[model samples]
Target: MAHIMITGGSSGIGLQIARLLVQRGERVSLLARDPAKLEAAKHALQSQYPDSRPVHIQAVDVTDGAALHAAVMDCVASQGAIDTLIASAGMIVPGSFLDQTAGDFNSQIDTNLIGVANAIRAVYPSMIAAGRGTITIISSGAALLGIPGYTAYCASKYGLRGLATALRLEAKPKGVSVCICFPPDTDTPQFRQEIAQRGPETKRFLGPPKPWPVETVAKHIVKGMDAGKGEIFFGFDMMMLDKLGPIIRPILEKAYERRNKKHIGAQEGR
Candidate 1:
């Protein structure tokens, strides 16, 4: 059985992954921001994995490098060595570029980019020492295709994709594998909130109305981690986009801008 530490394990895809891992008899520890959410997640998962050890929860904001480092160490200490690390915590604040505050941009960078780097730095030593471990970074399809009003979110996830690619090269020699995923429109509370905040006027610009269940995404992630795959682009359309992203990115960006013209103009006029 492998010990896994998942950041953002309080809910959404992270929580789903934790529950699935526990059911498979793997030891799971969660690093999250809310004590109450962590405790509730622990209770909910523990009831499902009755034979497993009490689910470990460390309340640490991923943006805090010191706290994140300490939390990773604490989880590693309890679990012996981390067999897998999933950088699954991320946030999205949807709006036109003009509507985006400096804080909004910074928060996405801090959480989605720097946060992943921090977690890797914290656990990499032990993973390298062991000469065997896997990392699954929960990236998004937005990282591949630029979307209207999701500039900050896309930039942060694109940064994660770059980081994961670099880490894969560095960790290969150490026998550690990295699996980065491009999960498309997962039906989590986060996605719901993003849709609601985008409002009816701007929603059409998002294009396509399918948001997949978190459980399906979580299952693909676990399987990819097990296989040590380099990348997993969840869903058929996302796979196609992954293949064409490099060539079509520019055209796609122009199309997205055209779709959001009214919203962008409105935001700029505010």
Candidate 2:
């Protein structure tokens, strides 16, 4: 069984991905900031696989490079060299740029973009020395199209796309694979939190796009990693954004602006 380590495996998409991997009997290591959540995740997985599939967990903030590296080393000792690293740990705080604090903005960038980098860096040496491994970066739609009230979110995700592109070239020569998946808004705790913070302009601009269950997204992501895809995108909207976004983004933006005019007017009034 492949050893898959997910940076945000304690909750949301990360935990869901771990669940799927455990069900398939793959060994998993989960890293997150919350010890309680980590323990809960381990229990949930172990209970399901009472036959005792390996499910390891560590509590460490992804923003701390040294601590992250140490946790990776410890997991490597128990789980063997990581066969796959899913950099899925991420955070978001939705608000218009002017209204968002510098701390909030920087926090998202730290966890989403730099955190992903740290996770990859921690495992890359082992993978390169072993002459093989997969790294999957979990980006978002904001990576492709800027969403209203997600200035910071978009900045971080866009950086991930660039990182994935550049890293792909470097990894290919080392017999390692780097893949980035842009998932649409999925039903996750973080996304729900973001929804709660969005202004009406942001909400209206987003419209009523339905969220994919974490189960479906996790399944797709795992399959993509297995297939060694360079990039993975889901659903029709994402497909369009990936294949024809340059042609369509302007049109969509104009439409969104028109739809949310009233919301903007209200914000300006305030």
| Highest-scoring model, lDDT | 2
- Please write out the lDDT profile of model 2 over residues 100-215, one tens digit for every residue: 99999999999999999999989999899999999999999889888888999999999999999999999999999999999988999887877777777677778875889999
- Report the Cα lDDT for residue 221, model 2: 91
Clashes of each: 0, 0
How well is each residue in 9-67 modelled by candidate 1, as lDDT tens digits? 99999999998889888888999899999999999998777888767889998889998
Flag regions of model 2 displaced more than 4 Å. Answer: 262-270
Query: What is candidate 1's CA lDDT for residue 215?
Result: 91
For model 1, where is the 10-residue window of minimal lDDT?
199-208
Residue 119, model 1: lDDT of 85
Q: Provide the RMSD of all predictions against the true structure, rounded to 1 decimal.
A: 3.1, 1.9
Following a full C-alpha superposition, what root-mean-square deviation does model 1 have from the true structure?
3.1
